[model samples]
Target: MVRSGAGESMRQPVRREERDRGEAAGGGNRSGGLVGWRPRVLEHKVRPADLRAVGEVRRELRQLLSRWREPAGEDLTEIATLLTSELVTNALVHAKGGALVRATVTDRLRVEVRDFAARRPEPRAATADGTSGRGLMLVCSLADAWGVRSHAVGKSVWFELGGGPA
Candidate 1:
């Protein structure tokens, strides 16, 4: 929770309000006379091989939404939770090494799951009675936007849920 440059630690909402009007609104972890602030973030490290990874990520997602200034709704939360579960499960089930889960709150909520696996995610049709292979479908249906990005060490699968008028 420590600020990146300074030694001060930061919690959710990522702001400091002054009792007087002079020092309430600062920029980049400093006290100044600005008006508003944004960019709330939450991150967690995960063990991809562990059985509890998916559920653990979903719980953290819930916790992250709780700190938002204006959350979308329970419906969006449910979809986002399901999306988180899908992406995290994909990392644990298919990817190598551990994973990192990050949730950023802005005009939209962006959830990114990173793992060392290089295999890209592809969607496959699932049968009515077939009880598997529907993760990406659910993500595509529920998320407003989604894509995968490759990095040297691993890849990141991310989805965004818009926080519009709900």
Candidate 2:
């Protein structure tokens, strides 16, 4: 049995022994690790009305993902951060009530910002004057794909990363 640096069993011999016994009974080798499983899911929920709270949420997300895997060559962290900021910003600026921000990482990372607003976000052309209306454009530029989905209460703006699960 190998213990981790933290002094916890890295792999339980009892489980392995049970598997070996089962395999011996059935005529097979049971030396391999757990046969079948899926990656764990990580989730976060935040209220979009509080900008600072949203930023902190984003920061926490970055730290968590960073510990799991090195950021892909693509600027995924930056893209995700920008995408979250833009979606949450839009929710706060345009929606009636506060918004819900949900982030999940599985085979890929997905961020959804939901708000009680039926209004569709318009794609704004950058004007020479340069004052307002470019958040969605930034989101479009950064995300692999993004769009708005309507719910009974309001809508959810969601984006996905191109790489494998975070």
Candidate 3:
């Protein structure tokens, strides 16, 4: 269990059944979410400095999106995959520590990457010739909503895509 800044304990790797009960993924009830309308949650763990885990997590996310009873379409899967890749890569590269990835599906798809680093991520100015430093930029442009939440140990960088499976 992970203790939040609010002193509430959250269990990691919430299962489908657990999520359906409206259990808090981050120390709070689904935030006035609709009754009986629970989210589907999935989790992945990336080892320290394991960039290969990025591709593994992306593949898992693709499988989850594809398994949705309601079609999320290829575009959503791609966008979510891309944003997740960015966040996971950042966590692995910058934090130089392990990361926990969580994906929750409600009316939208929200993915979060939690790392053991206090410093938050910021969008950088990418030059035309730069091959990197555009992760947050893509997230800002592509995600319907995105933000960073401070945790007791570190922070969670998250992004959401609207028009996702209900």
TM agreement with the true structure for every prediction: 0.73, 0.66, 0.75
lDDT tens digits by residue: candidate 2, 66-148: 74433544377777887788888788878868777777654456678888988888778879788657888888777766777
Write candidate 3's Cα lDDT for 19-81 as tens digits.
Answer: 545655454454355556666888998999888999999999998887665678888899999
The lDDT per prediction is 0.77, 0.68, 0.84
Q: Model 1 segments beyond 4 Å from truth?
A: 1-36, 164-166
Q: What lDDT does candidate 3 reach at residue 97?
A: 73
Indicate the worst ten consecutive residues by lDDT in candidate 2.
Answer: 30-39
Each candidate: RMSD: 12.4, 15.4, 9.7
For model 1, how does the per-residue alpha-carbon lDDT over 1-166 read when each residue is reduced to its tens digit?
Answer: 6485567777644211121134334424221333466567879888858858778778878888877767668888899999988888888888869789899886678889999988898988999999778999998888877888888988999888875421
Q: After superposing candidate 2 on the true structure, give the runs of residues whose Cα lies further than 4 Å from its correct spot.
A: 1-48, 69-74, 164-166
Better of 2 and 3 by lDDT: 3
List runs of model 3 lying over 4 Å from the truth.
1-38, 164-166
Model 3 scores a C-alpha lDDT of 0.84
